[model samples]
Target: MSPAASKRQADLLKQEGNAFFQKERISAAIDAYTGAITLCPNVAVYWTNRALCYKKRNEWTKVEEDCRTAIQLENHSVKAHYMLGLALVNRQKLSEGIKALEKSLELGRGAHPASYMVEAIWQQLSKAKYIEWESLSRERATQLRKLKVACKEAICNYNSLGNPAADAPEEQLNELEEVFKKAAKTDTPTEVPDHLCCKITLDIFRDPVITPSGITYERAALFGHLHMVGKFDPVTREALEPHQLVPNLAIKEAVDSFLSEHGWAYKIR
Candidate 1:
């Protein structure tokens, strides 16, 4: 067959693989993608598609191999790099995964800015970072998790009281606020811990915000970055808008507690 004919045949197989994949016929999708790759070894998409099938099967080694082959065939293959990053992270090669994800983000920004896959890539990167952070600070991470739970419980109890009438006793609301504020303020540390600081501002968060990507940052700092820099998240490079940020009340409470305990941490240079 001529090269054009061969490519067309490969395209048909790829489309078949896509259909199978969408149907969740993972093994059949793999077979179709493999057929495409055999027919058009030079096509990066064939390898990437096969890699995705392997990913669905939790076959990290095969995913890594196929994505590497795809990247070799087409250096600018965004899906390949993104998949490779996920495979690497699954294999506990976090640093390499982060680099691959960053490369994918860089390449994808110009070519496929609106692709939904970009969000997945960013989420994977975020997971990798969280894993790394947890590994390094397991104890502190546990503490933070507990603190978040406590904060949530506090909020839930307050809300369960129901909406008070506008004129009904302002003192009651103020008293409740003071109680929690006092709890957070009871123990001031001499120095602010690194984990408590916002990654973007390198300072304590006054108002913490969480993005859909599961990253937390200072509200104003993240808002500014989204508006002034780009719509992509700072940590994961995922697409995000200011409106997508949710107030991370738990983290906010935790930060407030930390600050209260370590009043000196509030002294910013």
Candidate 2:
């Protein structure tokens, strides 16, 4: 076959693969994508499509391999990079995944379809980074508590003695305060999880309430929004009434438990 004929055949195969994928016939989709790749070995789309099929099967290794192959064939393949990033993340290689996702975003430049993928990558990266920072913060807090206890013991021992260490405890406390201020400045601010935040106010929910549309929102915020803007779901734009709102006890309990565990996250603001 001529090169053009070969490429056309590959394109037809890819379309067949897409149809199968849409129908959730993942095995058939993979077979069609494999046929396309065999016909046009250099085509990045075929490799990426096969990678997507592997992803549906939760086969991270195969997804990563196929995505890498696609990337090698076409350096600027956004789908290839995005898929590789997801595969790496699934394999617990977070930093590598983040880098690949960032590269995909840079290459795509907020293009349609890929823009949504880029946004998802950003959210996952942000969540992972936040969890890492939270762990570090807890460790630092524990160390600081230990140091404070040691300082208190030292102060008590000095007071028991005849030695005049009048200003020493105060000075030590001032120094510790300075250290804490510096640490706070250096540390990343705690982030409220998206699920815990109210859609209307964008703050951590004190009392989550579910609307008839099955979307959760903070009670007061949603009530105020309903009163002001007329009864409607902010997210789904579903027609709703104030009476349709119901308390979401499950989400409220989750928020309470999270706050209790991560007290530092419960800022006054």
Candidate 3:
């Protein structure tokens, strides 16, 4: 086959894979994308598409392998990095995963600040950062507790040695105690404001939409409720439909501005 014909064939396979993926036929989608990759081995998107299929099945190793190939083929591929980050996270490689996620966020923001993917990448990065922060905070607290116990022991030994004039160990113990108290206070989790959250998902607004009744919800969550539950506002129980929802630009901008300063808001439960 000529290169042009092979490229055309790969494009057709990609479309088939997309259709299969949309239908939730993940195995078939993977096979289709594999065919595309076989036809056009240098194409980065084919590898990423197959990686997404693996991701759906929780096959972290396959996802990582395919994403790495995609990244090698196209270093600046945002989806490649994003999926790689998720794959690494599933594999329990948090630090590496966070780096990949941060790269994806940076690329996505540069390419399309208003794209759905930019927000998705930002949210994932924020959650990863929060998890890392929480883990480190716990470890530090544990170390501080151990240090406090040891400091008190040292002070006791110093006093028992008939060295009551030795203020050095006692002063160190007081300083350590004060540091532990401050750490405890600083580690307390802050609550996210309810107004910033979607009623159905109770998550920070991603694509917020307001209904006629002045109730706002995450776009996808509201769509799910309307399709699966009923065409009424989840909060007010008022009559509503998918068409009644309007993009709340004011709220969206507010949420975006807040997240710019407080990425930790993505730590929503």
Candidate 4:
């Protein structure tokens, strides 16, 4: 076929890939985009699209490779640099990633708000000394479910299953559920960034001393966590503060009573 015909074919493949991506048929989309690149190796769009698929797949190395290729082919590709920075940020290479993302912003390119916010949040994390995960609760679980859908659909990768873009296949979802079950079963303290840590901070940063008495032990402990190293918002402060569900006693006392009633650990904090 002529070069023009080949180019046309490549474009068609990219379209097909986009369609497959919408359907959550990630593997199919990758194949299509890969074919497009093979047919027209110099097309930057194909590489950028394929890089997105890699990101969804959680294959950072491949995402970086594809983005680099796209950038090399077309230095003006804002999408390529933005996504490259995104992948780098998530990989904990925040400094270089910030630079790339800043360039994308300076170029006034991108339709993704999450990308912008992530970069902004990372700027905060880079300044902090410690990060802690929020005590995951029902609300967070709901948010994770939403986030999982968005990331998967948006990124188009196998590992993007837990993302907020697309719903993973049932089997993968089940596997993920099991993993979360194991994690929730443990009391392990996990490190979280300022953004997420800020989310649950309300629960940790509240006015535990709701009564004339001193702050409840649990609320005090939770407050200590909030101010231990980093700062949190007042809303988060109030949320983390333990209160009295009992007529006069602390919420921790009630929790202890329930734990004793169930023969679990008496200490709620």
TM per prediction: 0.52, 0.58, 0.69, 0.43
What's the distance in Å from true for residue 239, model 1? Answer: 22
Steric collisions counted per model: 5, 0, 0, 27
Cand. 1 Cα-lDDT: 0.77
The TM-score obtained by model 3 is: 0.69
For every candidate structure, what is the RMSD over all alpha carbons to the true structure, in angstroms?
16.2, 10.2, 6.3, 22.6
Task: Summarize candidate 1's per-residue lDDT along 151-220 as a digit string, tens digits.
Answer: 6666556666775643234455566566655554433224566766789978766557789999988766
Which candidate tops lDDT? 3
lDDT for each residue of candidate 4 in 143-214, tens digit (9 for 90 to 100): 666766664444456544565554556656676667666644433333322221123332221112332232
Better of 2 and 3 by lDDT: 3
Off by over 4 Å in 2: 110-115, 135-178, 181-269
Q: Predictions ranked by TM-score, top down?
A: 3, 2, 1, 4
Q: Estimate, for each residue in 1-269, the C-alpha lDDT of model 3 and write its tens digit.
A: 99999999999999999999999999999999999999999999999999999999999999999999999999999999999999998788999999999899779856854467877887787778677767877787798788878878877887779875676765767887887787676556655678889877787886688899988888777877887899888878888977777889898898877655443534566
Candidate 4 clash total?
A: 27
Clashing pairs in 1: 187-261, 188-261, 188-262, 189-261, 189-262
Candidate 4 to native Cα RMSD, angstroms: 22.6
Candidate 2, residue 80: the lDDT equals 91
Q: Which residue ranges in model 4 land beyond 4 Å of their true spot?
A: 109-269
- Candidate 1 Cα deviation (angstroms), residue 94: 0.9
